[model samples]
Target: MADFDYDLFVIGGGSGGVRAARTAAATGARVALAEESRMGGTCVIRGCVPKKLMVFASDYADLAEDAKAYGWDAEIGTFDWPRFRGKLHAELDRLEKVYRSMLEKSDVEVFDSRARLADAHSVELADGVRKTAKHILIATGGHPFRPDMPCADLGLVSNDLFLMEELPKNVLIIGGGYIACEFACILNGLGVDVTLYHRGGQILRGFDEEARGLVAEMIADSGVSIHTGTNIVEMKLADEVDVETGTISNSDAALGAPAKNDSTSLGENPKSETRQKAGKRIWVKSTTGREGTFDHVIFATGRRPSTADMGLEDVGVELGRSGEIVVDEYSQSTVPSIYAIGDVTSRLELTPVAIREGMAFVETVFKGNRTPVDHELVPSAVFTRPELGTIGLTEEEASERGEIEVYCTSFRPMRQAFIDKPARTLLKLIVDRETRVILGCHIVADEAGEMIQLVGIAVKAGMTKEQFDRTCAVHPTISEEIVTMREPVRAG
Candidate 1:
């Protein structure tokens, strides 16, 4: 222990790493944290915080319309991208400072550079500084993944959204996942002509089918062109497209065709003016035989763990197929002294889960308590136009396990009904038939994220359906419907 430079050396400085470092340091252990980028990591810097702000900004468009319907002379104007981006970055900078101050107050040494594992018990910085620790933790998180396809480099990922100078006029979003749908809605609300192409029958593939269906309907109704079972087959810069007077090839049938090398090559230097301008306008041919020119092509396909070149595999730490660190319930890697958590571990890639796992790691290593982090009944939200909040199991999942009763309802809410808005809200409850316990709760409505949070507590507490019925409903609120729901719509 005396030979080690720190009692604990935590790598990556994201939510999980920062929490473990600060908590361990509170116990008077000499803890050190290394982060290559911003202090607050993905959630505060790029992922959740900034994305939610965009969600809020996007909602104002609908709000103004609703205001007009309510007889208020509320005028809606163009979204100021530059102004919003400036304030968003300022807020992120402030948050990073707060994270740094928290570590400083906790007496944890922080290194603002990249760190890689040198051995089971040591790490090396990018500057060749070597430090040994009695224990090491990895929380490097993840980055967006782009498929291996020609012209793939020409598309933007989720990270690029925050740095854009101006929103595009016509955007093509690829992927059926939450990130893709959320951005589609966000851009559409910002007055962009958005086309979402998901190579599936519907969007939000893994969510509750009913809830996701409602979301898809709302997204389409809000002026987004959704093309299910569609994908890009070939792409070129707008300038490179040959405007020939011939029949356009069937894009869907051209899926297996040898793609023609378009004028603007993907390998073109990004910093060059041509490449930069090309990003403004892309010509794409989709699998559905549709050819169109778009201002931008955004790929939200997926994300993989950021575990490459960190020397984890060299030191005998097992990695998953997607480069995720393989860790046990205690977050201990194959190597005894090494541990991993957060998105890097590929376990429930949410900020709260990462923070909790970090606390559990502290309890296991620093406090001499072997506490296993529970990954069950985690509440989550997809911030689409209407938003979807869910917890526990999906109806499809619960029915497969055992007999279940589904209480589902969809209707136009009072506010929208009064204004003759076509918008509708959905509230659903899945109960175990044998136990009469609420197995899952799904909501598709405004502030569904806020509603599902409270629902999480009830579901996690194993509250029965009767308990929910016993609770008094708060009048004139959307969430009150959760408690007031009676009679199962479908039981099996």
Candidate 2:
């Protein structure tokens, strides 16, 4: 028998890789892992953790006003971005330590370097060190992408948002996905003016139409200027825009459109030193031919798996068009010894899903138990101003499968009603007419993310509409409406 240095060599230190590494080690198999960046990958480092912290900070923006309505003397002071950023970094540093500790405790060997495939069984590191293993798992995760337009570097991706030294006074966000909408809400809550542009006719395209629509509505109500069917055609530095922009068309105006001048361009002060330090004042022209200058332009356009520069193809691993590693139900690549999970596989990009895939991979490979990944009925949450939680097939999806009845409700919850806020809560369930099974559940409200977890359990269990109606309602709460929604708002 040919001997290997380790039984399992896991690549990527993100949640998925870490889980697999530790679990495999616990099984008394020799395991090793490599990570070039922070140990926690995107979720702990950039993607979810810090983003959700910003969500928490942003949520407090309305509290002072709401406090006044609740008979409290309160006024929110100016946000201290530097201090918050410092603490955020400190927290991230602590979490990285925890992740490192988990591997160490599991007795998994760790290397602080990037790893790629040298062959079916050998893993190569950035420093040209090669480690041979019986099996290899790739979970390098993914990264946000910026468009390939001229002067596109002037725009920032979602990853850049966390590293900002100072938040911009105003920002123009491109793309209509959850990341774009989430950041729009975050910036608006942080007292920054936000404008959003998406070429799509609507945001959150894959989600249930009504639920995503409500999320967009609440985000826009929070003062995010959303322009669907729009995209940036041209981008230039303010200095260049000032010198070269001779003819500015107001696409909306037919004739006598006003040309932009220096004083009315972007900011009142337009400090050159500040502009240089804050990157550059960017002037953007929309596809519709309208123009505007912003302190920052963010492209939350898309994400690509981190498959570039890796020698996967040479070793016979199939990759999808998006550069995601192609794997089967058991998470095995075409090269049997090489497996992948997480965002790298592009199956389901959520952190928890990645972790689950890692466990399934372990069970299939190490335990003599072959387990195919179950990609069904996974619940997802978008942490906007009011969160969006969804599970199972959407009304549109369920209807296509067969006849579906959509029972949905939209109303100002008691808390918002008491404060007289325009915010409203939405609860929806899509049920099959014949099976009487609840095919989907969608929620748009505060704590919707938390609410959907238990709701997801029921949906995943294939509970019928009658089963839901059998449950008792928790009164005086936003979620009670979920159990109490009896009649179909619409049917097909």
Candidate 3:
């Protein structure tokens, strides 16, 4: 037998990595993990934690407006962006420390450097230090991606949005995904003029059409200027240029056009490139020839796997066409000895999925029990203005595969009816027509994220429409719509 330094060596101390390492160590297997950044990875540092705080911070605007109904005198209202940023950072730092402490308590050695594949069973740290292990795991997750425009350098990605010292008075965010909508809601609620642009006809593309429409309406009501089916073809940055007469003036056309040596026109008109200089803000011509600008631009477009620098090719591990690692139901990579889980593998990009996969992997490999993750009933949430929560299949998907009955209810919540908030909530239930089993539950409302979790459990337990109807409704609660809506509007 070959001597190994550790039983398992994990790269990336994110949720999947930490969970696997801690669980494996608890089973009496020696483990060591390496992280190039902070301990809690994206969820703790940038993605979930900070994003929720922003969501809460943005809610105060509406809450303040509603304070009068709660019998408080309408008073002055103010928001200090820098103060919120400071408090958010402090909390994040504390959480990072707690995660580190937890891993140490589990007896997992944590290395604070990038881990690169030296070989199938060996990992090299950033400083050329190398270590060998019997098995390896990669859970590096992913990073935000921005569109490639002429002045892409001047734009900000999702990760960078949290660190801004000052908020923009008017911001232009590009993308239709949840990240873009969430940030648009956050900024618009906090009094920033937000304009959202996307290439799709509708936002939240994969979600149910009605739920997506409701969220789009709620976001629009929250004061965001939304633009769908659009993208920036060119960005004309505002910069000073000296004219031939030796006078310096702010010129939009002064900056050279995007390089054309690469055969891409960059969607710019050569004849009118310098002829259409505008004011302080540069005009960005769209694919449809529309032009506008704002003080700041953010691209919540999408994210790609962060496996670029980790040296996967060196280890001969294969990745999917989408650049995610390929893994089986047991989270085992093509290389039998190594395994992967979480966003890197793209099974489902939720923390719970990753956690379950981590536990399952450890069970089969170390604890002598084989377990597999069932991805069919996974639940997800989108923290937009009204919030969105969903589990299982959409009505269209359920209908396409087999006959199904869809129950849907739409109404203005009591609070909104009183305040005239110009918004409403949507609830939907999809069930198999023949079997009568609940197939999906979708909610779009204020606390939809919290509300759908219970519904998810019901569906996961194989609840039927009759079972849902037999349950008593909690009077005056928004969630009661789930069980009370006995009839669905027919869709031919």
The CA lDDT of each predicted structure is 0.87, 0.86, 0.80
- When summed lDDT is taken over every stretch of 10 residues in candidate 2, the lowest stretch is 259-268
lDDT of 3: 0.80
Report clashes for each candidate as comma-separated counts: 3, 0, 0
TM-score on alpha carbons, each prediction = 0.93, 0.93, 0.91
Alpha-carbon shift of residue 100 in model 1 (angstroms): 0.9
Please give, for residues 335-433, the per-residue lDDT of candidate 1 as tens digits. Answer: 999999899999999999999999999999999999999999999999997989999889999999999999988999898899998989999999999
- Candidate 2 segments whose C-alpha is farther than 4 A from its true place: 240-279
Taking all chains together, the TM-score of candidate 2 against the true structure is 0.93
Order of the predicted models by TM-score, top scorer first: 1, 2, 3
Error of 1 at 99 (Å): 0.9
Pick out the ten consecutive residues of candidate 1 with the lowest summed lDDT. Answer: 260-269
Off by over 4 Å in 1: 240-280
Off by over 4 Å in 3: 240-283
Compose the digit string of candidate 3's lDDT tens values, residues 1-492. Answer: 789999999988878889999999999999999998888887888788999999999888877567776667776467799999999999989998998998999999999998888888899999999999998988888777545545564556677667766776788888998889999998887889998889999999888888898899878877788888888887655532322233433355435434321111111223222222222343456767876656667777777677775677667888888688888888888777778888888778877788788888899888989988778888889999799999998877777888778899888999888876677899999888788898889999988999888888999999999999999999999998888988766532
Q: What's the CA error at residue 188 for candidate 2, in Å?
A: 0.7
